[model samples]
Target: MAVSRHLLFAILLPMAAVAADFPPPLLIAHATVIDASGAAPLGDADVLLRDGRIVSVGKALVAPPDTQRIEARGRYLIPGLWDMHVHLLRKGRPEAYFPLLIANGVVGFRDMGGDLGFDEIARLRREIADGSRLGPRFIAPGPLLDGPYPTLPSITRVLRNADDAAQAVLDLQRAGADFLKVYNRLPRDAYFALAATARAHHITFAGHVPLAVSAREASQAGQKSIEHLFNVLFACSSQEDALMREKARALDSTDVDERRQLRAHYLQAVLDSYDPARAQALFALFACNATWQTPTLVQRRAYAFPEQAAPDAALLRYVPHDQRWRFDPGQDARLQGRDAARQTLERRYFDMDRGQIALMRKAGVRFLAGSDAPDGEAVPGFSLHDELAELVAAGLTPMEALQSATRNAGDYFGLGDTGVIAPGARADLVLLDADPRADIRNTRRIDAVILDGRLLQRAALQALLDQAAEAAAGP
Candidate 1:
């Protein structure tokens, strides 16, 4: 992807003259580079960037007289993070969320689903590619394909049958969507059709497991990734039919005790039927087929405590006031309004989130970290770090958790040169003041971020956040 000259002019006009004269290469000296490709961090190393690409990386490199140097000192430098799932649309100006992603140290994202039009999103992708926008690299699925009448406002297209499913994939491909998203309501035939068509066209199919399709069947049928852990829980169960039948009967009944019994039965069944060998086989299919999992733990956590007052301070700070209100407007009241029976049914779903994560990891599932942010209690940017922290709580090592956001995502998306710090790689790196390996929370101690050779200090990143907040507040 070549950066356009016009884009350069539009973005760098103020600093153009100062940047024109080939000043010595920007050198990041004496930093520990955690080059995310499973390599040992190099101590006392310097990375030199020129023309937005890494030119050299090693120790004992002499800095040229004209070289502008960043004294990394004792900081840890790693590849800029990637959020595999995000909704790039905001409340007022839908396009405002992109820059905010960059501001929070995300250099790239995969928009799992959003409300933006395909043409507009394509333009934004191009603009970011051309350097016309100060945003992270984007990959989008355009819109969702739902069935039995699309319930979500974000879904612009719906599949009525197998033909509709095939045509929907074609339309999404034509609209420049990078993948096809399957929703929960899709019919079995339509689900298979969508997956087959996507495979034939070399488009990745991802999202929820329809009620008619088991996770095992979907994996074998070429569904690229599963968004939530619910699908896996379904597959891991040895008695899915019995469980589903119980749930259906519970739904049909108004008796509180009956519903409670059914809910308890389902949870107990899940714990009893969780077979490690079966999980390993299922995850092997995922790994063999190059499938990915975007476990949006933040949303899972938020929904876990439905009766809670609101989101925590860190997440609340990033969301616009109106959007925050929209997400939690008397959520406690709503929870209270639900009969105890119905509340328990919903709560059962929440309790399985951590267990699902643990089971997936135990089976060697390839996890991709995502917040599902700015929707419900999950805020963007900052919420991603919370996801990392949650993954650690779920038994993933800090390095393993970080890999889910970096190298793992890049590999899944076929981005060859962006996830690791190496010669010839793009200069998207984060310099942290503390050792994140020691404590995952240390990732918050960001000193600076380098995006395609452009150094943004902490103040500049904060300014970007303020700009996003302002735009989100607009009429």
Candidate 2:
């Protein structure tokens, strides 16, 4: 079961070998292109793709004699969307999620946390890159590092102290992890040590801001990104209250009311201390500091509303019947006597967290759209579109929300040639039925998804989704 580096390369070698043959160019014509670069959408444009790269894009582009042409009339083309945060191995088979993501126009994803073997993930990345697999590009950490009893069970290692944290980073770097993911339970010293070690190893540090460390400290310490919107909530809190809260004991179900009161007090203090001058200074620091945030509002909304705990129909199709009962823990925990109170606390946390996201956006903090999809209430590819919709609800314009998934993510991850439709950019683009520039919801009307110039039509996309659902339902 251990996927080794050699095995991974073996799995990918066929794709690279196939790509060695020069294929005929693919020409897509008569499409409306939304390049995600804030450029005006081009009407009746033609995109020329050759050997898995976009060679030209313009109106009335002439195709070579041997080029295979795809007529895309009535479709709107844009760069493929990126789910900036996801956990590929949460549902047991990380590979199953790839086609589902591609089906819904998710051409790239950052694995915020997962238990996937690095070799397997790297293999999948290579296979997709070389056109062996029908999937999106993947960026992932090897495993999660946390103190004892981390919330997510997929965490492969635990850090007990600063030394453990430092060693964990080096181990992950050796394992070829794309980044170091820190969890919420680590102590202040361990968190700082991990950050320092990640920097020394030149590995990107990302994940939850530990309760013991202030968000500002984590940002200043070179943590590349923060997940779950918790860091922003901590950042918006009054510095004095944040310091006090950091020393408080871990929260428990019995102390739910007390936690809410403390959180409210901290939030009010933050709002009261909201000096525009101070906020501007803080925003400047974040802008230059390379810190990113994934709001993951789709998951937030799902956790917030227990009254509506039923799964979305599209999502339910992919979740196994045996696992369906896992969706509503409160209902399952009716015999435990703690369900009601826990549900109430969850709802409260959701509302406050969303409010914190609004505040962070207003303060000019950088954000990456992530669904945390196919995890609990999130529904993989569909959840990302919902993230964009929720972001629009939080006051970002359609373009801004789209940017969060496109150019913003590409720029943040140093993928300069992607997230745009230019002369030399990669051909990872989606063709929608409607103009998403006019409305964010139009993003869902996907007509086709173009990955490295190979187009997957809507019917093909549906087939991929069906295949994933079948795989998830299998014995």
Poorest stretch of ten by lDDT in candidate 1: 1-10
Reference-based TM-score of each model:
0.86, 0.86
lDDT of 2 at 216: 73
Tell me the tens digit of each residue's lDDT in model 2 across 45-68: 999988667899898998889998
Instruction: Give model 2's TM-score versus the native structure.
Output: 0.86
Name the regions of candidate 2 deviating beyond 4 angstroms. 1-18, 21-23, 126-132, 239-248, 252-281, 329-352, 355-359
- Tell me the tens digit of each residue's lDDT in model 1 across 399-474: 8888888888767766566678888877788999988788988777888988878888889988887877776665
Q: How high is the lDDT of residue 179 in model 2? A: 69
